[model samples]
Target: MEEDTDFRIRFSSLCFVTDHVGFCGTIKSSPSDFVVIEIDEQGQLVNTAPSKLISKILPEPNNFAKKTKLDLQNLSFEEGSNQEVSIFAGCSGADQYHQSGSEREDTISDGTSKGEEQTVDDLGTLLDEKTNELLNHFACDIKEKWNSKTELIGSSPEFSLGRILDKNQRAILHSAIRQKFPFLITVGKNSEIVVKPNLEYKELCHLVSEEEAFEFFKYLDAKKENSKFTFKPDTNKDHRKAVHHFVNKKFGNLVETKSFPELNYSAGNPNVAITVRFREKTHKHRKRSLFEYQDRKVIYTDDSLRLGQLKGNHFDIVIRNLKNQINDSANLKDRILEAIENVKNKGFVNYYGPQRFGMGRKVHTDQIGLALLKSEMVEAVKLFLTPEDLDDPVNRAKKYFLQTEDAKGTLSLMPEFKVRERALLESLHRFGMTEEGCIQAWFSFPHSMRIFYVHAYSSKIWNEAVSYRLGTYGSRVVEGDLVCLGEDVDDEHFPNNKVHLVTEEEESANTYAIHQVVLPVLGYNIQYPKNKVGQWYQEILSRDGLQTCRFKVPTLKLNVPGCYRQILKCPHNVSYQLKEEHDTDVKMEGSHIDEATLSLLISFDLDASCYATVCLREIMKHDF
Candidate 1:
């Protein structure tokens, strides 16, 4: 299907397949544009449609005091919809319920369901409108400071929360503070309350660049000889190595190290601080190239991919799903066959395609994946609730859930087809509003979906890697490039993970093909290219708030073992013909095809992980 290219290409990795000034065309004029028939590993053509009919009907929950109903199609707040939520639901607290408004009224618990109004105390109370606004503003600032000065964990800066004169309201104030600022430590003494950055809970070190590092050291006034210019110590070995790598890249030869015990040694991590000073004037700088600076460990590509071609039969697929009569448009029907031949022979840039990133979404799926990998469950949940169109009904449901914590009402507003959203809601409803519940809600998704998030995030990086390779080096395979070692081009039994980095041995003999070169998806197990692109991977990952390491969240039990993907892919036996006038007579199941005259029925076969939209995008030279 056609999509908005600007929203998807953040890294600006878009490059063309061939220099063909092709004609323009539109797609997704009708639902027929999304029709895709998948060819399985056994060479059987399978129609790509959800065959399992779903008719899930959920009953009402006891959290809501008012009546609610479900609407499969129209999930609106108006009266004509199938369901209507009369009042907001509260959390798992017995007597505490949230009111839907600017200021939610928290009921006073009298050991019963009776409701009573409460006043805002001198502590950091969010019950009042002004106080809530102030808390939000300061909370954002403190969070930033906490993330930046992560080295000062136990001794973080503190902020006064005024006096909590009433001892009875102190518990209530503490509860409110926890809700707003989870990463904070609170103390009340002699009716005076204060909060500090709870750095022990979170580990964040703002990633820096070479120039930024130089500026940081300069700002510290560490110019004199024997000055201990130390990079912040981290338990995350990957991040430490990344910082060490970049530091060594710039100042390894200039500085001489005198190793000492690791900072925070009692934490049981084998992390050492980069404590060093300028070398003596008599010592000479060691000669080394950029390639010699990479970690000594030899990492290989994912073994799943083989350095070979995919041999398969091709079939016809729709080029563009236009609505109105199109035979009159730009003589497209005449030249489409020629364009098909060009794409079939030359192939297109093997991009991950906009579909992988959740095209048309307000927040891409990969972002949600990144949050999950980072163990930011709340952030992942919020990103998942993001709506493509803010004004749509989905946004209303999201807002309602965020404000009132009403899982049942949110699910009612969500579309029936949204299985993943519904799954999260059901999980929350079953598990209640607890910290464990949030993690369980994340676990409700299928493993394939969980993997897709990380893969999508990596795809963004991979797309950039490919673009840089092609844009910088063009079609020629350069030294330090990687080539898979296999028995035959199509041998399935060969160990595909063993790869040889291009050097004088292969480049001089012209041994490997361009298709054999591969790129990694940025993870712990996967390797990088031997040259600058490999180095670029570490820099990019650090910039994106991670190092190339395993995301082993014990609670989530999620591990993203990275894989390899070939930079380019080709279509098999591509051929095209004009759409028939009588094709409209043949009706598709549950939907009608809008007849168009000038559309092309271009058919081609692509290996798994390849996108048909990209192949068509190459031919059309348009967003479609």
Candidate 2:
């Protein structure tokens, strides 16, 4: 566990937050030794539990129903006009809550409940008598069943879904649809999702204010579109009260739904309307997830590596198997504990971690990214094909492919699980290994992977800026440092890219702190800082062979708008358990009075894009 001084020197992540002496230990000695759990935007712990549910296993009616919100709440009417369906919101997290592993309490609409099993009888009940004629499960041409449900159910297909605002969950549901029934594709009018003419209504009354109800109709009048719907009528108080469970569980109030009974029971008077039409254009984010993200306009395809991509998202991490450093101090454990406390309190530099740079590989992705930026496709492809990890089997395959230009021949020797390599090879096999072919081969990757190299190169520039900030200004809020309107306003749905520099007056007033300060990741879209750091940013780009970085690569059809990240990161709820392992080796190198075997179980919660390894680096004082 030695410090990678070379990387630190090059990337500019060379400084520590604390002045305390540091110790060293090995990390990820085993797979279980290091564990990471993602905390999504809702602050709920994300796991594979949702996939384990029987409903998610296949694309059946239950599969669609599983994610499709029981939220038939969007439908309202012109106060005087009956059966004129308008959409309204429920008093819940319509903005924040999408199909985020939430299970709604209310059963199927039309109120007679069968289980998740999509039987003929259940279909008949759900579709109001048309489904029996429409749904044919056992028929010879029974390839796609969900299609029949769409036709029979018409505009009220949301009964099959208990969706929220989580785009990832929507993607998961849509993926199932695409897998089973490839024909569920198509954006509706308004470029969202199309709705059927027949609207299905299910009214389980809770309560909403008279004014909220009126405003609800107004919102629907202006913003009515397909995929955003709910049709619920006031059934009873208990069912409405049960709406509490549905609201709390599914939306958690991310999207404000005025239709919920409890929100404003006594709006102006002592009461409000119990029976009502509630419509909310639910397809806003859901369809955006389906279609908008294909261009990756706002959100990344993968779990976000960038800061606050999943707004408020964080990580719950555990680091174990900590080897005690050999030292003269009588209290080595105390020293280690003190270091951990410093990291907990003082925080660490929010540098992009080595994983972003492709640490284990012989060549880093940032190098490849820079190559791409320079339009050196051959160099970039060669860098990508380079081998690492001290005798990986792919080395032989890569060697044969590069030497012979035989992508298909190399595949037989290549490992099946090496999907990126396989994909590159397949593209090359089809497109031939010309310069254009090489660029296209890179394009064959998912948008995220294709964009990642550029992101990494930008990350290197960001890291350099961070290093300059810490090293020159010393991690303090200074005059001309960039600060957001408030805190980090990186919500993808509604981003606030606006930033202002701290003035001398503001700095004197202590208006903006270091935590509030930000550094650009460097791109065509982002504005640089106003001070010397900004000058460094410009100089860095010019040094990289461009006066300004190109955000678009027309050759690759890639567009990378820039982003910002915090300069410093502090972990939350930090705690540690120091214990000796069961069969740990006790070291007694030269001089030891009373030192026994030692290990640490260090745990912390870090916000999205803050590296846990960087936190551990601060504690361990080893850059590796």
Candidate 3:
């Protein structure tokens, strides 16, 4: 067997020949299995695995023209011969035959020996044919692989050829390979690969470069600059008040402000929306107004702001169907009305809703609040900084780093966009890793967050007190019951003027009308009722190893000057409507009712502090 001495396949080398057909274009891959590309009759590259040519070897090229001409003539040789030679018979633009150690055949298979003589131009023509065939074959293979891999992964595949290439080098090589092969690989600025498809091979090969791909990817990953302002309120301020204060502080004058009704300043759902405008339409006014505020993400802008308010203290809820009866019962409205009246008379439990606690079944904010109340600074810091079980990857990383005592390291790992967390970590780094430092860091968090901890603890106590009061007294106002005077009273005041003890005469006069009884939210100035419900509140406070004075943290100024909350709530403006039943209503068995059955729609409103779901529970008498 003759050896091809001049050419050798090596790692990262471009190979133009394969085992299948002789005319396949270059492939840039590590040597693996024997794959080949061939030129079809239409001058397009085709991938094939012809068994006969698997063992065939091409002679090395001392000269490009001579070597290609010789290889083309040897394309039809019989298998397993030590020195087999073949003719380029019936091949387009070629008419000759060369046998090993023999002269060229004069009469071709087409019965024409004319122009059978070898020429330099013919060699060059063959070389171009081989080059074009190989290039086209390479492009087809790339397209096929790119499409299949992208489909399989549901994204672009990251190409890693070998360990020899560094990240940037690999990206450059990938760009070059994609250009020659006409694949859809896009090299990002950070060397990330993105796949863009259906580009014409010729056009793509000409237009794309490694630098261009890098820039294109960078552009893809670029973040849009926001021209709006954002402001979060202090823990003590309601969202409405916070926005008002923020606008006044920045603009020096109040702008047209529109905001939704604010919820209680609790630990959960603390976001508020508001829009403001400036008198002048200058970028300087917008930019100069911007200030560096920690524990808040603020945006200032000159864009026209349009927002609709979505919150109201009163809600008109429509409940469909009091009873699942299909027939139009004449007393259906009366039944629903009676249910609403029963709820009002019996009184609904005013336990703190799920929003008071942090998300999920387990409440985390209460733990942080308790730690702060007990002056356990280290525990408070840990509880506040660490993420909940359901937190995402970024939060988990921050938690892990903080737990591992890498406080300084956590600053870098923490997201720059999380202003609150960044402020906490920056405080920790500044104060040094001590208990006092931790407390200071905890304090440095958004005032709203700090207040949330205290509020959550108070809510926990309130919830327990309400549960105990309901279980014992069963919603009846007794002699010692503290009834709130009116609905529009704040809960955070000592010697609350809104609450008055229920006298024996008043309790007896309107036994059913006692819908509002006040309970103590334990704090320094709270006067617990001498009644049984107040005893439950004292028991809960004692069980948690807390006293009213414990809430007065002078350093933190988070003193909860105890307040009163109504023990019971009732819905008002009650009304009901009956309509024909739809397919959604589940029918009871053994009931013969036509399709024109009636359904109920009950509408009512409740106080802002009360949950409509709780009111519904009273009417439905089922767990919601």
Candidate 4:
């Protein structure tokens, strides 16, 4: 009787036992017997017995056999191998079987050439090709199911097979398919795939309001040619103007080919840029007008304005010491670095820098804000228009006329560019000189300037609060101290510098950083911190004879919801260098010097809403 043994198999061939246990794997020959490296249901590879195993082949409906044979031939060759070989399987067309590592000589299968021998390299290639074909078929089946069910197929068995084959390769293939096909697919940050267009697409379609669309279309019909519209300077313009302008130029207007935001060169810091749309016919003229309008308008001589250039809220500044005064007792470089590090680690009390107020010694802009808050319109108007003797002759003459002459007569003396000021004077002239008339006249000023005053007052309140907090608590957090979690604005748990009061347990834990304390920007909607800090906020407002509810100005439609901000800021990417000054005639620190001196140059970036001068004050330990 002949001895019974298991049969040899190709890679990725599905096999079944008499007991109906099924597996897919490549076959390898051990010294004594044949073993199948099986891929389990979980897509993990494992060794199993090949005894009583039978191959299960699934046939395709059209040209299945021919395509399979072609695929096998195409994929069988190993990379960089020169040898030519053929694969023969034991099936309906085969006549002989060759066992791997058997001592007996190879016998030809009926379909292959007689006396041809197979190499180990040929067998490995055959296995690899079949394995890849199985994986591709598996991936396609999973994709079809995913499309039908309209659900994620990440946990599907077929997807697991494809993942086992190649992880990054499958991702690239899916991305390409999504881009090429008509169907839309969205992949989220967590790799969750959804068959839907992005939310931004829907938002783009509905960006223009019905009222805006009607007005824009009405103007387009009347004009026929593209119209040049300029927004009122110094006014608080709506941000939606940009969106409306974009939609009108892209789809509504018949003549316009492009649209862009118009750069406002005259608006001071935190300037608002207007949106402009134009046709090909007006493009050249509009371009020329922009150059003429903004030329020499910026405060800095080196700055120039173009149509689309917008200002960023954040800025980086470099400050250098004009003269490096060296002393044996102290090293300037070491002192500067130590000062910066100390501020970074220990934190400095926050204050509204000099720029928040007007530049002149006689006027404080915060006072104007306070007068507006108190509804003292006459004071607000006087502060806005009155020019000191130090001001330019043109401005001084205009101020003198406004103070001494009647409102109607003073209008003629005001400059043409003083549109807001002239409007206020005209209102005062028409409404009479009562308190109500003065209030109405103040209302004629630009809404932005009115809001600026309110902001300046808020800054002053915050500066005082910071000073009080530091004076009482010093730099470290004590029991009942309020500490901010982190610096992320989008964190759901701690949005906008949310703080938690330190309990006795937390104080003992000592995990919270001392520099995490934040101060409040006083407004109607803000809840004041509990303790001395809260008392300080109340005292400041009480001293000014103002209430938090006063921030809700119904007449102006301005409601400020307050927010918390860090009491200290650290400079990032800080660096310093020393260079010798070549000029001898220049004065150093108000002293006449004939010798060349070394200058300390420092550079760093600061977060938005924080002043660079604040950091410099900490480093210099002196007022500017």
Top lDDT prediction, candidate number: 1
Q: What overall lDDT, based on C-alpha atoms, would model 4 receive against the true structure?
A: 0.43
The regions of model 3 sitting more than 4 angstroms off are: 1-312, 316-347, 361-363, 486-498, 502-513, 548-550, 575-603, 620-624
Residues 1-624 of candidate 4 have per-residue lDDT tens digits of 111111011101211111111111111111111111222222222232111111111222221111111111112111111111111111110111111211011112222212123222332332346643553454455446434743221111211111113323223332332222212221211221122221122223344443443344333322323465433232333445555454442333223222222343444433333333433432344332212211222232122222223211122232333322333245555555566666655444455665675533344567777887777777777776666555543365457755674776666555322345556677877986667887787666556656777777788777767767766776667666667876544111234436777777777788676557666686665566677888888888889989544586655556767677677666554555545656444222234446654444444444445555555556555444
Model 4: residues >4 Å from true position, as ranges?
Answer: 1-329, 344-347, 394-405, 417-420, 490-497, 584-594
The best candidate by TM-score is 2
**Which scores better on TM-score, 2 or 4?**
2
Per-residue lDDT tens digits of candidate 1, residues 151-232? 3311224444455455446445644454335555344434443454433233212354434443433322222444566655
Full candidate order by lDDT, most accurate first: 1, 2, 3, 4
Root-mean-square deviation of each candidate, in angstroms? Answer: 28.2, 20.6, 32.9, 33.7
Candidate 3 lDDT over 486-527, as tens digits, reads 644533332566677777887688653445677777677666
Residue 584 alpha-carbon offset, candidate 1, angstroms: 14
**What are the clashing pairs of model 4?**
none
Candidate 1, pairs of clashing residues: 316-603
lDDT, each prediction: 0.53, 0.51, 0.44, 0.43
Candidate 2 residue-wise lDDT, 348-432, digit = tens:
8888887777654456778888888887887788888765434545687777777887888877766533446666778888888
lDDT score for residue 26 of model 3: 15
Q: Choose 3 or 4, whichever is better by lDDT.
A: 3
